[model samples]
Target: MGTMGMQGPQPLPGISHVIAVGSGKGGVGKTTVAVNLAVALGKLGYRVGLIDADIYGPNVPTMLGVTRQPNITDNSMMEPILSHGVKFISVGLISPGDKPMVMRGPMLHQIIRQFLQQVLWGELDFLIVDLPPGTGDVVISLVQTVPLTGAVVVSTGSSVALQDARKALEMFHQVKVEVIGLVENMSQMVLPDGTVLDVFGAGGTERTAAQFGLEFLGSVDLNPSVREGGDRGMPAALAGPESNLGKPFFEIAHRVVSRAIEISRSESDVLEIS
Candidate 1:
C-alpha cells in the first residue's frame, strides 16, 4: 500500500524537501551517514543544506570541517557556513569548547526554529537535518515546526541497535512523518584476506525493516577510511567516486532520492484522486 496521504507542516521558504537522518541510539554512525548524504546530494548537483539539529551532540560541524563561526548579515540573520560544496550549520560550531548543551525543551525549540527560519539558507533543493539520537525534545520541535519530507533511520546489525531503530521509526510514524527508509550502518567488515565478518551479527536491521514493511535502503560496511575522514572533517563518501568507503554512500544517496521521488508521486496521485 502507498503511504497515507496526510498533510504535514509546510516546507520552509526556498527549501523544497526536508530529510532527517536519525538513529535510535548513538555510536551507530548516524552523523556519518548524514554528513555523507548531504555531500553526495551536492555531488549529484543539488543545492543542499545540512543542519546539525543534534543539540545533545553536534558533530556535523566537525565532520564537515567547519571550524569558524557562521557570519551574520546586517539584518541579524545567521549565514550558513559553506563547506565541501554544501551549506551547513551546527550547534557545535557556536558552542564553546566541548561543554555539553544543557538546554531545556523551550530552549531546544527556539534553537531549532532559529536554525530553520533565521539562517539564510537561500534557495535549496534539500535540507538534511541530522537529528540527535533518539526521539527527544528536538525531534518533537522539528516535527511541530516544519513538515518533514521524510525520515531515514540509521541502525546497525546488532539487536540492541535495531531495537532502538524500531523505536525511532515508531516515533516518526506517531508524528505522521513519512519514513523514507532504513540504513544499516556497520553491517559488516571485509578483511584483507577476502573474509567477511558479521562484526555486529548480520542482517538484524534488514530483518526488522522487513517485519515492519519498511524499505531497507541499504547497508554500509565498517571501514577505517570512513572514521579517518570523519576525524579530519571530510566524509568518506566525498573521498572520490572510485573509493571503496565512498561508493556505498553514493549508492545509499541514490536510494534515498529514489524513495523520496516515489513518495512524492504517491502523494500526488492521492491528491488527484481526492
Candidate 2:
C-alpha cells in the first residue's frame, strides 16, 4: 500500500497537497470550510478530491447533495462520488441514508484503510480531508498512518472554541504533525451596507495564531447563504464565489496554496544541503 512506510513524506506524488481541515470542537463550521475549500481549489483549476474523514458525523454526502452509493470495481477499488467538479468519498455515503454508524476502533481503522487502499483516487492536485472535531484516536490514527502534507485548524473567534483549538494544535505537535495555520470561521457578520459586526467577539483566533507564530489564513464571514446552502444540501462556495462569504473560502484556498509552496521549497532546500 502507498501509505505503508511512506518514505519521509518527500514531496509525494499523485497529489500535491493532502490537507486535514479540523477543529477543536464541532459546530464551528469545520466541514463547511473543508468542502468550500475543495470547491475553491477546483475553481482555481487544480484537480481536487474531498474526503469526509469525519467517520462518525459524516456529512459530505449531504453537503454536496450526493445520494448515490459508489460502486466497487472487480479489483476491489471503489469509485468516489463526483460533485461540483470534485471527487469525494465519505462514511456518510457508505451507510444507508437512515442508519448511523456503530463501528468500533478496529472497524474504523479497517474502513479508513479501505478508504485509502480501495479507492481509485485519480491524480489529484489537492485532497482535502474533513476530520471529525477534537483530538481523538481517529485523528491520531490518520496522522500516524497517512502521509499528510500539513493541517489547517478551523475555529470560531470565541474563547471556548479557541481553548479547544489550542489543545488540537498541541495534539498535532505532540504527534510531530506540522500545522499549516489557523482559519477563523464565522468570525464576523457582514451587513447590507458593507459593514462588519464582531458578533462572535472577534480576534480570539487571530490572537491564538499570533501567539503560536502561525499564519492566520483569514476569517470567513457568517453568511445566511452558507446556512441556507447547508440546509438545502448545497455548498455555499459553489453557488457564488463573488458573494461576501464565498469569497473568503477562495481566498483561503489561494493562501493555503501559497503556504504549501513555501513549505515545500524550504523542505527542498533542506534536502539539497544534505
Candidate 3:
C-alpha cells in the first residue's frame, strides 16, 4: 500500500480550508473543540463541514445528535448529515454501536481517504477534521493525504497534558504542518457561591504557546453546561454568541480563521514565486 508519504498531498474538492483539531493524548476534549469550532464558524456565516475522523472512538455523531444515516447520491457519494448549520460525517453514524474497530494501518488509510474523496461535502468554506489524539497512523495518513491549512492542538491545564501537548506540537512541526494555535480547555471553573477554582492549574498552556512562538488562542473554563450541552446534542457554541458557556468557543474560532487565512496567503505567495 502506498502511504501519504509516497504521494503528493491531495487537496479535497470543494473544500477551501482544512483544519485538524487534535491532541497529544485522549480525554483532552479535542472532539468537543472541533465540534464547537465548526459550529461557531457556521454561526459566523461560513459554510463549514466537520469530519469525525476519530474512527476508533467516533462520538461526533452522538455529540451533534445526528443518529440518522446519511443519504447516498446517484454518483454513489455519501451525503453529509447537516446539523446546526454545519455538514458533518462520522464513522459512528454507520458503525454498529461501540464495537471496536480493529483495523491495521492500511485499512485506516483507505477509510481516511474515502472520507475526504467519497463524501459529497459541497462547497465548504472550511472542513474541520476531528482527529484522534496522539501521533498515530491515522494522523500521519491524514496529513499525507490532505494539504491541511493548519492544525489546532488542544490540551488541559495539567502538567501531564502539557507534556503530551508539546509532543503534538512537535509532530505537526516535523510534518511541516502549521500549528495554528493552542486551545487550553477546562482551564478554570467557578463555584455556585462565586468561588473560583483552578482545578488543573492555569496559564501553563498559554506559556507553552508563547515559548514556541505560537498564538495562544485562548482558554475555555470548566463549565458544567459544556458537558450538559454535549449530552443534550447541542454544543455550547450553538447556544449563540451571547451565552457565557459559548463565548470562549466563538473567540477561538475567530483566531483560527485569522490564522488559517494568514497561512493561505503565505502559501499562495510561495506558489506564485515558484
Output the lDDT of residue 264, model 1. Answer: 75
**Which residue pairs in model 3 clash with each other?**
none
- lDDT of all the models against the reference? 0.88, 0.83, 0.89
What would the per-residue lDDT of candidate 1 be over residues 1-274, giving only the tens digit for each residue?
A: 2256765455688887889998999989999999999998899888999999887788887898877899999998999999998999998877847899888899889999889999999999889999999987878889878978899999998989988998999899988889998999988999999899889977888898899999988888987878889999988878755788788888888898888878878888998999
Model 1: how far is 35 from its true place, Å?
A: 0.3
Stretches of model 1 off by over 4 angstroms after superposition: 1-8
- Going through the candidates in the order shown, the clash numbers are 0, 0, 0
Model 3 lDDT tens row, 1-274: 3555476777887889999998987988898889999999999999999988897679888778877889998988999999998899987776748688777889889878878889989899999999888887777888878999999999998999999999999888988889999999999899999999998877889989999999999999998898888877899998877888889999999999999999999999999999
- Per-residue lDDT of model 2, residues 1-274, tens digit only: 4667664323335777778888998989998888888888888899999889896688888888887899999988899988887899998888857688888888787776677657888798888888889987666656655677678999999999999999999988887777888999888897889898887767889899999999999888788888778767778778556876578888898899998888778777988999
Question: Each model's TM-score, in the order given?
Answer: 0.94, 0.91, 0.95
Of the candidates shown, which would achieve the greatest lDDT relative to the real structure?
A: 3
RMSD in Å for model 1:
4.2
Q: What is candidate 1's CA lDDT for residue 71? A: 92
